[model samples]
Target chain A: MNAPILWIAVPFLVGGGILFLLRERYAAWLGGGTAALLALIALVIPIDTALLLGPVSLKIAPSIQILGRSFELNTADGPLLAIIYGLAALWLFGTEASGTANRFVSLGLMIVALLTASIAVEPFLYAALLLEMAAMLVVPMLVPPDQKAGRGVVRFLIYQTFAMPFILFSGWMLAGVEASPGDLGTTIQAGVMLSLGFAFLFAIFPLYNWVPLLMEEASPYATGFLLWALPTFTTIFALDFLDRYTWLRTTPQLTNAIRFAGVFMVASGGIFASLQRHIGRILGYAAITEAGLLLLIIGLGSSEIINLTFLILIPRGLELVVWALAIAIIKGRIQSLRFADVQGLARSYPVAVSSLILAHLAMSGFPLLAGFPSRFALWQQIAEGSLALSFWVFLGMFGLLIAAIRTLAVFVMAKEDAKWEWNESWVQTIMLGLGVIGLFILGLFPQALQPFLSNLAPLFEHLGQ
Target chain B: MVTDTVSWIAVGLALITSTAILISRDWRVSLGALAVQYLAAFWLVTRHLPLAMGSVKLIAGWMVIATLGMTRLSLMNLEQQEEDAFFPRGQWFRIALMGIVVLVAAGSAPRIEAAIPGLGLPIIAGSLLLIGGGVAHLGITSDLLRVILGLLTMLAGFEILYAAVESAILVTGLLAAVNLGLGILGSYLLIAGSSPLENEDEL
Candidate 1:
């Protein structure tokens, strides 16, 4: 049996079938169960070897071909697959609580499958088209049947579509660059096209205007899923590019550019987040800040950067899940997500408000939360390299902290006569409560992730070396 | 591969139809022009791709136009039946801008050709016109239908140029899927945007 077909294709087929055969009430269980099962299978299957399970021995092939093209998922991909599918299950499990179970479970699973396929597809340039297809799938989820498609959705589609040709064209030029490494013009042209394509894909700096707009427009849970899925895969794809091209990795100028972009995003995202009055938009900017932190790790170009990047990323999925759940819960109670609209909501939905605050503080890199350990390592590395850069990064985190404090104040603003209550259902309370504990556990003992994240860099021949 | 004469004709038709789609105010007329533009793109793709794969481009394009057509037809109203000219108040400005873009594209064709060898002057010019016109359309309007048309036009241009560079079957298939998906999404947005429920909810 082929691993790519088993992991990617099977989940896709199951997701499509679930949309047709299953009722709305069963979506969360079936979808989450399917995702969990896939994650478990991915975790158990060994690449390049046979596995003994009870009475049976089975071997899974690494690659599957269709129409002369290939999709490959090898041994090195096991951890990545486990992380993706596990996070997907977490999101799917919360769909019922978020009130988006109907379409979210089905379409969300398919989107995850397509994105995983993008990472596995051979020639790698074909990944650009697959990414575009995945982005298009996000449209219906972002814009509900009853609501008009917002500017955020349109811009998201346009920017994603725009990245496709650039990346494809760059692939065409990159071949020329490889054949004629000494050709300056070819190298420059290829490098510019590649960076342009990635900038659009990553939504770097000014291009990231759509993130907050989308947060304000779409269901927070769905937007959170997009936030987690696209960038996580794209960053891996970017690392693959750097690993494959010696010229790109060795160029100091490229690394410097990455550093500047990272600093700009973190600094800008922080400043803007501090000024925002809307809770959803604040989370959007906070996401931008986290993305910048990941870029900063990539820019450091150190031996430990890959593990550090994954460390940053693992907590990110949980934080977003918790945060988006809180937002969705509050949104169901209030018409708007502005600070004013949610005033005194803490008096009603204490669990959701507490979850939102903890998640917000976690993203701000507060001590003993999921985000702190990675941020600490990142600061140590950056401080050792350049104190000014570290300062800017800290400033960005400070801005996020201020936003968190302001949000808390807003939620605390209730009439003296207002009585505290538990507005959340038992399910939401349990799920959110568990998420908060997970964040704290992961924060205190980050080494638990070491076994999974330690060897990921070796997948790329020269990436972290 | 297509002959020089066929290629030039296709390029010319592409330029005309894309312009018509941009300049036409009536949604039905714009979609009609878009179909013709797709046929022109298909002709261009045939020069680089096999007949079956090239036909996918044309079929996907028409499918998009048909999707939009059906959505518009479903929402037709007697009061909205009157034809309206796109950029009616800025006809001269739009015409002059188009003329300037054409001239600029014509001048830059050689430079672009030099930068990426083997792509002919016709392909370069046609792509430039489509891309330039599409960007202008996007900048000038926020209307859902118009924006969708602009995006489709830009994608067509990219496909034409990209076809000359890579002829992978999977790429072609994926691009076709993107086109169809865009159309369905555009149609859904157009219908949703026009719903009376939206206004009622807003109030």
Candidate 2:
């Protein structure tokens, strides 16, 4: 296999093998090593070139067919793969960073692999299987046998499993049409199914609790994988569907509907996040709300919006990593993440608190921070699209910003409790340092990213128009 | 015409099974009902394949696997004694009534006309039963595993509908693997020597 393909596939193959061999302990190390290697390869090698291995020729293109349907892996997929592999590496390393076992790493690798495959598989129905497989992998990682698996893992799986049929049906609906996304009937069915699948996959509205509940019950690292990988993949996959369905781009009504859904998700997510007492739950809400914003950007069906959407995912993905680590720190120290429980934590470890604040700020789209530029660009798109709708969207954006500010006030600025002592580890300091640098790098020099962002412009324009 | 009748019967059976899962309090019956639903789904799918020896072999092999899997699951259940609490009879009756309405509506949908001839009504009814049972399970159950099982049943129904539309064997096989993997994972979490339920009260 070519290096990029290997980067995607080897982790699952090796890590799964290790899981069976070493069962749990060495599986983490093996999986982690594979992930690190994959991340390295992702950074070094572009996703190009077909691999000729024995009888099989593995191709990398805009799309590929596995059994009967076609799946595309395009130039636009570079950043997404990078993010998945990068997160996989971080998650693997995270297992060792804490004293947790390796199951999470193994499962993480498996899910990432499945996600990569989902992006490349032809005839999109295979993506449904990949998604369900991702859920299956998540179950063992989330709840250990010694502890009763929370209803949340099952619930998460249930929700995820439900998305497949819709995706499959949609793909099948597309089968009779010409392969291009230009066919109107095929495009319409594909768009609707993709929308329904995404709505279910993302767990919007009545189905939304799984994210929070899973975060509440799962290991922080597993939660990181769930937030970072699954939704990220699903969002990209949804975008890919949009890419394939020309009808979605042609239908102004569809785009408008999507935009409305996005704003609604952001508003509802922010409102819920602000209401949540548990820090992890708060993170969950914030993540989902951010997802809403990204989707809203996607809904605009504009090159400017899509480019910003991709840009935002990078910083946001990293910010989630930092936030998850921050929660892990809090959990490690105090064993609870409730507001009252983490009260006065700032006085003891200013480094951790500062890092948390940066993460929170990035999440909120604070001015001169990682999230600000993309959020600003996104707003421009919204405002230009429709003033009336833009007014409401801006209001929702501010609401989220206020939620972030409140989290900062409550968690980072609060007086330290007299009883709690700080560990003040160098690891915490290093993580904090990275978070600061990351925020500044993306925030101050948005133009520095223009070359990379512009390179992706064509794909978005293709998708948007 | 014969295939069409068989498809409808299978669909009706699935709808009945879904109702059985919804109203019946016993987990055992639900499992039985779910297995039957899967078999019905499997039967409906078999009718979709091209009428050739290869397709017949493929269908037969899957049926055998289904039968074996069901047998194993049944035996495992027989080994466990705790009974699940039943839903109220009124709720079951209401759900059944609603299911019938959904069945009729799906049967009457304009899309039904375009469906692959033998697969239409069964696929539609099976899908309704599946989604209805799943929603009902989620609405009614507090127990985590049972709810998951209900969701699985729901997925099974949806898969049947999709398979009827297009039997991309690889995708279907992958889906089966996922289902089997999920079941194994769930079972491992629930019954593998140590159960999360052991300390349920403490939690």
Candidate 3:
């Protein structure tokens, strides 16, 4: 039994089946349940090892071949799988509340599965195709029935599709570079192509215009899932590239480029987010900013980069969920996600409003929230290197903080005659409340994640070394 | 590998038809030209892939054409005028731009071919023309159908180049799936983006 097929393909088949056969209401439960089960299996079932299940011995192999290619998920990938599926479950469970359960749950599962397959595919370049496939699936999700595909969706598709050729060509060139290590031209071309490919994939800076546009056009929940899934997987894929290529990791020029890109994205995303009137766009920018920070973490080229990346990522899922949920809830009540449209919403949906503010604050790295500890570490690291860069990053954080404050002010702008009421459903209340509490808990004690994250760096042996 | 005369003719026809698809005013003409381009591409791909696999590309392309045609019929009611321009005013500028793109692609193909040695000249030139032209179309047009067409064209170019480099059955199969998926999605978007009254009337 191949663990990858079980974890990746099985969920995809089930999810696709659910999309075809099941009713909308059952999607949340079924999708969430499947994801949870997969997470559990990933956590328990050791890859390339035998397990005695009451008298029957079962061996789950690491690699499975299909048409001469292989999909391998080793024991080192256990935590990563657990995390991916676990976060997937979190997103799936919330779909019912967000009112996008039907297709989001189904397509979300398939996207996650495909992304997992991308990671596990033997000829790493094949991952590019899988990523593109997963991205194409996002089109229908972003553009609803009877609606024209938005510029954001179109740009997103084009940009993602454009990445494929660059990556494939880079892979080809990299092989050439490997063959003749002294060839400077081949090396330069490969590096440029790889950078361009990742730029599109990560939606770094200029390519990220589609993000806020997509957030505005698509359902917040669906877009949030896209935001979470794509960046997380792409970062992992980037790490794989770094681990596999000694030249890519060791080059100071590439490291500096990564750092520069990170700082630019963070600074720009935050500044633009501060100027946004729509809550969805702000959250979109915040996701962009967070991605930039993650890139920064990786760019730092420290032994602890992998751990730091995961540390930032774990909290990000929660923050995005909270933010997206709040936005969706508000959107259900208001036709538009603009602050003006949602004015005085705090009086009606205090929990959602507070959740939104808290999530935004956490994203801005406010102390005693989930993002703070990671942000602090990153800041410390950067400050040690360049105080000027650290200050710029801080300015970005301040911009996000201002956005959070402005959002709070807008939400609380109620008429004197307005009455307080709890408009959120029980599910929304529970999810948002738990998410808010989780942020605080994780923030207060980030050590809780150390056990899981501690083992993750070793997965990339070269980088860890 | 030595290039045959028939292969060169097919490659030229493919490029010509691809250009025609971009320039044609009538949607029907564009669709016909697209099918021709696909057939040419099919012939070109046969140079690298087995006949069975190469046919997959042709079949997928034709299916996409059929899907797009059906979608166009369902969504828009174009007049039966033979000489109607797709874009009445911007033809000259588009033609000039396309010409420039073709020149650039033609100029760069040999250089690119030298850089990536195993790929043939025809494949290199065809891929470059299709990709460059398709991207230019994408940049120029905002119409959903045109954007989809541009995307498909770009993918076709990619398929041609990629098929030469990697001949894995699974990869070919997956690329075919992507092509068909894009067509289905493009069709859905076309119908969805149309006026509600038109959609209701069609239904």
Candidate 4:
């Protein structure tokens, strides 16, 4: 058995089959169960090594060559895959709750598998094509079944499509750099190509206009899933670029560029988020800030970069889930996400609003929440790196804090005589409650993720140094 | 001598066809221009790759055009089909952009050829024209069909250049699949967008 077949091909085909054959009622359970199972296997089974189970010996091959291209998954991938699929399972389990079960179940799994294949693909440049495929798959999931397509969706597709050529061409240029390392012109060209590719891919700062538009147009739940999923995988993809290329890792200017992008996104996303009256758009920008945090993790000294990156991703997944789920629930009750429209929403649906507020605070890295520890780490790094950058990061967090307060005031604008009601479905309540509790537990303890984060440190062989 | 002539012809064909796609008001004409642009791409791709492999670009690009055409046909009754304008919106600006693109391609092709050994200047220029034209198309319009057409042109342009650099069958096949996916998604968007919203303000 090979790792690529097990993790990439199997899930891909099964996800496709589920898309065509499975009933919607059965999809979340079956698909989520399959994902959870895959995550379990990844955690338990070691690749390219022998294992004796009862009476039989099994070895999972690390690499497989297909049509002159190789896809490899090594032992270090276990924790990473486990985290990815585990997160997929969490989101899938909520698919019905979010009313996106039909396509989300199937497409979500395929996207995960395709992203996994992207990282595994040799020539590695092929990862760009795979990433594009994953982005294409996201379109059907995002567009409303009966509603007309939104401008955000179209822009998303166009912008993502632009990234591939830059990346592929960059790969071709890098081959030249590999042959002659001293050629400054070739090096600069290749670096520019790569940075442009990532800039489009990450939708750095101003290019991320689609995020808020999409949030306004699409379901907060589905868009949330997208805002969570795409950037997470793309961040990993970016890190792989650093890990594979010695020149990329060794260059201080590149790392500084990454830090600049990180701070710029954080500060800009947060400030915009604070000023927005639409709750959905705020979530969108908060996610932008959070995505910036990931970039900041990458830009930090490489020793703990991998650990810190995965360490924060776990909380990010939770925050987005709670945030998206709360918005979805509230949106079910209300017509629009505008604060004016949802004034005194806490009186109507207390649990959903609280979850929304809590997730907002957590995303902004408020103390005693899931986001604090990671934000603290980043603060320390940025301080040591540059205080002006640190202040900008702080300003971003302050903006998110303002957004959180604004949201709170809107939610609690009801008269004192107004009564609190529990309108959220029991299931949604339980889910949100659990998600919120998970945040505090991870926030308060923070050690629960240590084992997984430690295991993930070795995933990128060169980045750890 | 024949190869050189075919290459230059392909470059000119790409430039004209891509510009037609940009300026044409009718979707049919734009799609037809895109079709001819693929033929030009195939001709240039064959300069480095085998006939069997290079034809993949032509076939894939044609299939994409067909898929989109069929989808547009399916939506014709539902959508209020647009007619040709005496002067289309942004027509002059598009022409100027294409002129600049042509000039840029003309200037850069030789330098790019020198920088990357084993690349032909004519093919580079042709590819750049397609990419530049597509980018201009994307920048100019927000219509669903036009956007897809523009993206396809851009991908075709990149594939022409990529074929010269990497000839692996898997990569070629994957790029073809990506083209088809984009086309299918475009068609889906067209059909989806054809259905009018209940209210103009509805999200």
Candidate 5:
């Protein structure tokens, strides 16, 4: 395997191996710090492949054999891997300060490894196993002992598992087609299964309870990571599927369904989050909404949509950082996240509160934040003589905006019973300040990142077409 | 047609057993029902052994669930045992209902004209059984462990189905790591006691 791949796996292996070897404090810091460095290194490395075992080489474009099937990575995979691993590393950093940091780092890296394999492993069956594994890997992060294992963790596991058959069956259908000569019958079977499989895996619509259920019991930090990374990786993986089978992209009805699902998820998530009392669950719902929006972009089948997804993803990372840090600072002492509890909080911790507001605005797709540009372009595309889609997209955006507004009301406008005080460290202030600046920079100078998004565009474009 | 006949029978039996466990009023009967379902799964894998190393995995997962269930049953104090929970009829009905829905849904999917080589009807039915089990798990069990079992069953179902396609050794090896993580997580949850039951709505 390539050094970069090793870089990702090392922390997980070492973390798990030494989880009980060292003192808890040192183990967590070591694991988290290692993961962070690995991520930084991954971002700098040019995507390359190397031999690991025989013909099963790790390369930018090399064949991989999984479950008796062959798969290869094209040049496009480099950026996807970089983004997935890079974000994962950053999420690991938050783990350093939390209770399950060791397990989180271990599982986080393993997930990254599995996701990478999902991209490179062929025959769809390999990807199926990898995806299932990713879901299982999260069990450690989500279900820690001492907390009664509520129905949420199991629900999440069941939902993901139930979705697995669709992928497996679809892979079988695809393989059968490959074996036979021009079998349209098998292709259609594969197509239907593919759609259903993805729907289940992504937790679209009715199967979506696992998110809220799991969040009900899990750490906000872990939930935040799960919300952002799992769905984002799955979205990218789904794009890979469309890229592999060009005809899927041409089917406007399918695209329309994806768009519709996206709109529904965002709208529903927004409404749900607005009513939620817990801050963590609010973030989870927002992520679901964000995921729905990305799907809509994919359904649009434009290269620019891929660019839009990337832009959306990067800034969302900042939200996780801000939320995780804030939660850690608060230490779960606050009773409720209702606007009422958050009242007078800002007076005490202006920097943290301001960071929270900016993050919320960015997440809401408000103007002058990182989310604004992408949301603007995406909405513009939706509104182009397609009022039905435009309406749904607009509604989805509006739902998120409402959720953000509600959060703002709770923290900014609600009255408090106690006098406010500020006591967070300077390091936290610096982090939040940088996060706000990052959002502004991205929003004000979208052109600066245009080249980066454009360079990565062809990878998706080629596969999609 | 031969493969289909075997698969349908296997799937049918598995589904029935799954529903039995789901609807069973007694915890002991539910455990018994689960055992039968798992045995059927093992049988399903044997029917397509060349394609399915999944049976070994299925057995391993079932063993874990069975041990945990036994432990919980043994550990439950008399007063707790007398309590209505860990065996709620309402929840059991939900499990049965979900199982039925899964069965109908899986059965209703358009069938493949021919079974792929090395992947016969038994494996297909076995896979469906696993999915149904998952549905039952999520629906019937409110306890964390039971739900985890449901999820495990669901993954087992996915694995059996996956066997009918490409047999990627590396993927299987990688999935082992995932399974290990599941084990670790389950242990952790058992260690982490539950919070005071809350009626609070999740965000």
Candidate 6:
């Protein structure tokens, strides 16, 4: 059996089967179960290597060819697969609780498989096409059959479409650069094109208006899942670019430019996040800030920082799940996610609001939370380089801190006679409880998930400092 | 020599069709213009690819139009069709944008052709027109259907440019799939968005 076929093709087909055959009640279970099983296989099995069990010998080959194109997975990619599918499992399991079980689970599976293919496809340019497919797939999930397509949804599709051709063009140019290594003009153009491509793909800085807009329009849970799933893969993919080309990582100008982009996104995203009134929009900016942190960490451009990135990244999934789920639970009861509408929600739904605030604070990098340790480590590293950049990054985090404070005040400003109560469904309470616990565990013991992501560095050939 | 004339004609048709799609107040005209635009796309793509290969874009584009047309045809009754204006509101503004785009395309095509090498001026010029027109279409429209058409128009332009540089069969097929996918997505969104209105109209 080929590894790519097992990991990519099987799940994609299975997701289709589930979507056609199953009801919503079973979709989440079946989808989450499939994701969990895939994660376990990725964890236990090594690609391109033979495994013997009982009297049988079996090997899962690394690559599969379909229509003259190849999908290849090396041994180092196994852990990455494990981590991705595992994180996806977390999101899938939360769907039942978050009330987006139907399309969220089935399409989530297919989207995950497509993203996996984006990594595994050879010549890698094809990855852009696959990513485009995945982004389009996100639309059906974001806009339910009952809801009208909003500007955010259309904008998301358009921006993603706009990004594909640039990346594709840059990929062709990069091929030219590889052939004539001395062509300075071609190399420079390729880098610029690649940067522009990612600027749209990552929704960096000003291009990120759609994030908050989508947050306002779509289900917070769906938006949160989209935010988690896309950036997680995109960050890995961006880091892949660094790993593949010495010029991308080694050139001081490129690296510095990248670092500046990361800092600027963080600073700008934070300022906007703090100023937002709607909690959904606040979550949107917070996710953008998280994306910026991932970019900043990648700009740090060492294998160790990549390792640190996993620490930042794993907790991010938990934070978003908790935050988005909390919002979903509260939004079910209320009309809007605006601060004024949700004021005093803590009195009515303390568990939901508390989890939301905790997730917000974690994202703010408050000490002793899952979002803190890695960010603190990143802070120390950035301060070593430039205190000025460090200060700005800190200010971004500070803005998140302020937003969390504002959100907290709004949640607690109930009438004096109002009493705290648990309004969450048992399922929501359990899911949110587990998510909050996961945050605390990671915050206290930040290195625990390292085993899943430990070998990710070896997946890249030259990215190690 | 005849083929060269045909290619230039195709380029002109592309620019004209794209402009029509942009300025047309009626969705059917926009769709009809999209159909014609695909023929232009086919001709320009034949600059690098064979006729059979070039037809892939045409086929994919027509398929997109078919999907969108069928959806809109069904849902057209749901929306109250406003009387056709000689130029819709902001129609003059859109026309002005197209004028700028045409000049910009004329100005930039030679430099792009020089930089890329081997791509002719017509291919470069038509692509820029399509891109600029598509962007202008996207910018002026708030309607979901129009936004999608804008995307399709823009993608057609990009497919033509990319066909010149990388003529791999797989790239051709993938681009075709992207076109088809966009069509289906747009159809789905249009139908989904209009259903509530359909329900209301029935009421």
Against the true structure, what is each candidate's TM-score? Answer: 0.96, 0.84, 0.96, 0.96, 0.83, 0.96
What's the residue-level lDDT of A33 in candidate 1? 92
Which candidate wins on DockQ? 4
Using lDDT as the measure, name the better of candidate 4 and candidate 6: 4
Cα RMSD (angstroms) for every candidate in the order listed: 2.6, 5.0, 2.6, 2.6, 5.6, 2.4
- Model 2 chain B weakest 10-residue run by lDDT: B194-203
Docking quality level of the chain pair in candidate 1: acceptable
Off by over 4 Å in 6: B78-87, B197-203
| Per-residue lDDT of candidate 5, residues B1-92 (tens digit) | 77667657767767766666555555566556666666666556555455356555555656655655655564455325424567644665
**Tens-digit per-residue lDDT, A1-465, candidate 1:** 888888888888888987777777898988999899988988877776887889998998999887689999889988888888999999999987887846788889999999999989999878998898899888877887677888898889888988888898998888888898999988988989998898989999888999999999999999998998898888888887888788887778888898889998998999899999999999999999989988888888887868888998889999999999999998988899998899999999999999999999999999999999998888889999998998899889999999999999999999999998988999899999999998999889989898888757667888777
DockQ of each: 0.49, 0.43, 0.45, 0.54, 0.43, 0.51
Candidate 3's error at B83, in angstroms?
Answer: 12
Report the lDDT tens digits of candidate 4 across residue range A394-432.
Answer: 999999999999999999999789888889888788889
Q: How many angstroms is residue A35 displaced in model 1 relative to the true structure, after the best TM-score fit?
A: 0.9
Residue-level lDDT tens digits of model 4 in B103-136: 9998998899998877898889999999899898
Evaluate all candidate structures by whole-model CA lDDT and list the values in order.
0.86, 0.67, 0.86, 0.87, 0.64, 0.87
- Sorting all predicted structures by DockQ, with the top scorer first, yields 4, 6, 1, 3, 2, 5
Report the lDDT tens digits of candidate 6 across residue range B1-203. Answer: 88788888988998898889888878899999999999998999999899988998899899999999999889866456443323347767878899999999999999988888889888998888898889899988767778888999898898889999887777788888888999999998987755654443111
Q: How accurate is candidate 4 locally (lDDT)?
A: 0.87
User: How does chain B score by TM in each prediction?
Assistant: 0.88, 0.67, 0.87, 0.91, 0.67, 0.91
Instruction: Look at candidate 4 and give me any clashing residue pairs.
Output: none
**Candidate 3 runs further than 4 Å off:** B1-3, B77-86, B193-203
- Candidate 3 chain A weakest ten by summed lDDT: A140-149
Candidate achieving higher DockQ, 2 or 4: 4
Error of 6 at B108 (Å): 1.7
lDDT of 2 by residue, B27-111 (tens): 5676667667767767766655444422433343344335434544644543343343334446746576656646564765446
| TM-score of the second chain of model 6 compared to its true counterpart | 0.91
